[model samples]
Target: MPLPLYLLAVAVFAMGTSEFMLAGLLPDIAADLGVTVGSAGLLTSAFAAGMVVGAPLMAGLARNRPGRSSLAAFLLVFLAAHVLGAVTGSFPVLVASRVVAALSNAGFLAVALTTAVPLVPADRRGRALAVLLSGTTAAMVAGVPAGAALGTILGWRATFWAVVVLCLPAVVGILGGIPAQPAPRGPAGGPALRTELAQLRRVRLVLVMLLGALVNAATFGGLTFLAPVVTGTAGLDQWWVPAVLVIFGVGSFAGVSIAGRLSDRRPGLVLAVGGPALLIGWLALAVLAGEPVALLVLVFVQGLLSFALGGTLITRVLYEAAGAPTMAGSYATAALNVGAVVGPLIAAATLGVVAGHRGPLWAGAALVAVALLVALPCRQVFASRSGVPTGPAR
Candidate 1:
């Protein structure tokens, strides 16, 4: 991998840390702010909601600009938001900072993909993409857990402060490491947003994107708040929370690698397999919650499969939307944010009615079913174009 790609990865690492660290610190933030845990959770939702709104809007704004400059600028915006978040005293102000961070976060990922694609050869696109995106999983594994630990020891506010401290070095690293590659200019500059939106009308392509989003969102929606669910219902020790999260991160890391390799050859197979694997994992977790050993083993396996869909699905969407790849990435990002918002809300709601954390597992299973149904239409659509059945992309 090139130095530039690694710099991009650092930016991604920062985004991942900033985005996910909130969940681990939710309890702390709630207590300090003198609010309910639910209110603090809105911080997570606000960020996701920002991503949902920001991805397309920011990507569209940069349509005519150079991908390199846009990516760099977004990182600057992201850094500033974190700085504000750390310093802000009021809760509403903190949410406002999150919204700003959200815009930067969504824009960074969307543009990063767009920026990265042009740097590599066509046949090597999948591998290059895998390398760029791996940073996200790495953050899940390393950044979030570390932040959680920091919050536990120091203070939740200090965690945000720590993230802000990371940004200074990150900004410098990105500027130093990334080369001056000129922005890509299409034959007529860039296509109009209207033209890009029209590409969605291709029934098969749009369907696949939606299916990918549904699957991606369905898994994350529940999984994001798994810590709270487990802590509340399972009656686990507080120290165990970080350990459980670290286990999930380990699964995520392994899943990204496996998913990347498989997607390069067999995207459809990975997606098909991932959905069932995740469903089973959730089911196992629900049934075995009482048995500490069984629950841990099941959740680990579930975590591996739960996120296995990310790389494969992203590649699938990229290939399907080759006509307008950046827009496709944006659309996918929007689905991701939509899922982020919907997942926790669903889990919270399910818990409200049901007595145990089982509600989330059942809810996730239902979502996986929806993802599969959505994928059915998409499979037929992609089959005709690629002249490949529901096997591997290779």
Candidate 2:
């Protein structure tokens, strides 16, 4: 609720837009570069790979420092990457710029969540994280739409330029808006990073984080291939694809907002309902490919239910980690990156090997089922600790 938090959200919004806008612009980038769209799609893969490596690398380097200034520096790095991406002439150079952007992107988010955790009271940690994570959803709702429109009119590179332009004022906002806060000191006696990593080794915590990863994989595995799935299989108009995605984005934002409220009361119940609903949504798409309206409805439902699990899993992991919030946040960011990478690879193998788009939907359903099993154990953990603390991870 603080001004600083809002500024942080704006930066996240920009980053989210830049990261996701590539999905809609793949064709444009491919056409301009004279490459296959699938090859151009490596921009997303490159970004995810960077995040997988960057989250820990950047967070570890920034550890034990005042995170505010470090976060600002990372944002500057993110801004520069986008600017270079806009101007780069060669495809490989553009890909490299995206990788740079991804590193900054992952680092910025990990740092932001670490800074954000201690900003509010302990009782509100789940809500705070939900608020922070909402920026990603808001990016889908607002940034993706805006970027897609810009790319359509001015070219894909122009959208990257637009993100670069936004980052300048965002930097100004960060300087003027956010309050200076020191890094978190460890509880009682300080623990070394090795101790912190050891604390996170608890099986329950690891399971919850892996569950989060699987849920993310399922959602994105199907989603990354969504536009093509609808156009090629559902026989929908190409121009209408972005509109469908916008609807899904709206659903995602709505789910994220609702999940925050639900986590406070019945985290387990939310997952129970959401997990099954997600399975149903995917099934509807697999069976109803010819019905575009039906498919879009399923997409909306899928987004709504798939993301409903996010807050619950994040809350559970932070709670389970107990004494390593920054490390936990860093690792949580890493788990998410793992999911992001897995989603695309899973989709690619299924669709590519099978030579059909339906593979992603089927594979996504199976992934969700695995998440569902993981959720059962999560429910038992929460149920047994009905009056447990839901404080920040540390």
Candidate 3:
């Protein structure tokens, strides 16, 4: 709840907006750049690819740097990339800009995750993560939709400009609000990268992050193809898509709120209850994509369960990775981006060829089912570590 945490959230909001708003701007981008819409869609893939590569690389490179300075530099690069993308007439240049922006976004997120945990009490680490991640959910509910609307009125370039403008205050806040000195568990004085990577071999940390990847694979895979399911399969009007997405967003926000309050105390309980419920929810969606009423109701419920599970896994990552302060954030960031890339590929492969509109739902269900299987024996792992360590890192 500190000002620094909120400032980090503000920066995350801008980055999250840039990440998801392209969903709505793709057609316009393709038209303006004289490329096929399918080609412009590659920009999204480029961003995810950048994130996957950047998260660990950037986090490792800046592991011992001043947090505030690192954050400011990342924000500056992100803003500059957006500016370049907005003005560029060449699609290749625009793609390059997206890649650059994604790298900046990944670095900021990797550092921010580690930065947030130390800003609060050990017991409140989950809450701190929620505060930072709320920016992402808020982007889904407001920023992405708003960007799409702006694109409608002012063109896609405006959305890029908006991201640049929005990030300016965050750069200032990083330079001012956040302290130059590291937090108690800060990575500034943490072990070398080799030693940090050793902590990743901790079985619990490995399992938790792997679970995070699978959970996100399910959710992101389903979400990436949801708009089509809504309009094409569920027989809804195009206008209804936004409303359905908003419902999901509202549920996602609620999920994160609940996780913030409960994850620190009852993460095991959440993982036990919510994880299976998420799998069931995805399975149900896979079976009922054609039923509009079912689709409408389930989307919100799915969002709630998926993200509740997500937050718990993230907390577990922090707790289990207690020995790896330097690389912990990158570990979490890479898992999510890995899922972001793999999920859609799984869903897209199933689309039309296998499950038609229901492919993504099936893909999601399969991923969660695998996650549950992975977690079944890992109950012992959760039993071992319950909260973030209050003492030194590991």
lDDT, each prediction: 0.71, 0.75, 0.81
Better by TM-score, candidate 2 or 1: 2
By lDDT, the candidates rank as 3, 2, 1
State the lDDT of candidate 1 residue by residue for 228-333, as single tens digits: 7557767787666677777777787777778767765676677667777777777677776767777677767776786667666666666666667557567767
Badly placed stretches (over 4 Å) of model 2 are: 183-190, 353-355, 384-394
Q: Over the stretch 1-394, how does candidate 3's per-residue lDDT look in tens digits?
A: 8888899998998998898777666667888989965466567767877888899899877776777888899999999999999999999999899899989989999888888876788889889989998988888788877886788779889999999889988888889888776433343455656887888777777888899999988877777667678777899875566667777777888888888887788887888899889989998988888998898889999988888889778887877777777667878888777877787677767875767878889989999999999999878776544665532321
Q: Give residue 227's error in model 1 in angstroms.
A: 2.3
After superposition, the stretches of candidate 3 with alpha carbons farther than 4 Å from their true spots are: 26-41, 89-92, 182-188, 388-394
Query: What would you estimate as the lDDT of candidate 3?
Result: 0.81
Task: Give model 1's TM-score versus the native structure.
Answer: 0.91
Alpha-carbon RMSD, each predicted model: 3.8, 2.5, 2.8
Q: Please write out the lDDT profile of model 2 over residues 5-103, one tens digit for every residue.
A: 678888888888887777678778889988876677677778888988898788777776666677889899998888888887789998899889888
Q: Could you tell me how far off, in angstroms, the CA of residue 38 lies in candidate 3 after the best superposition?
A: 5.8
Q: Which candidate is the best by lDDT?
A: 3
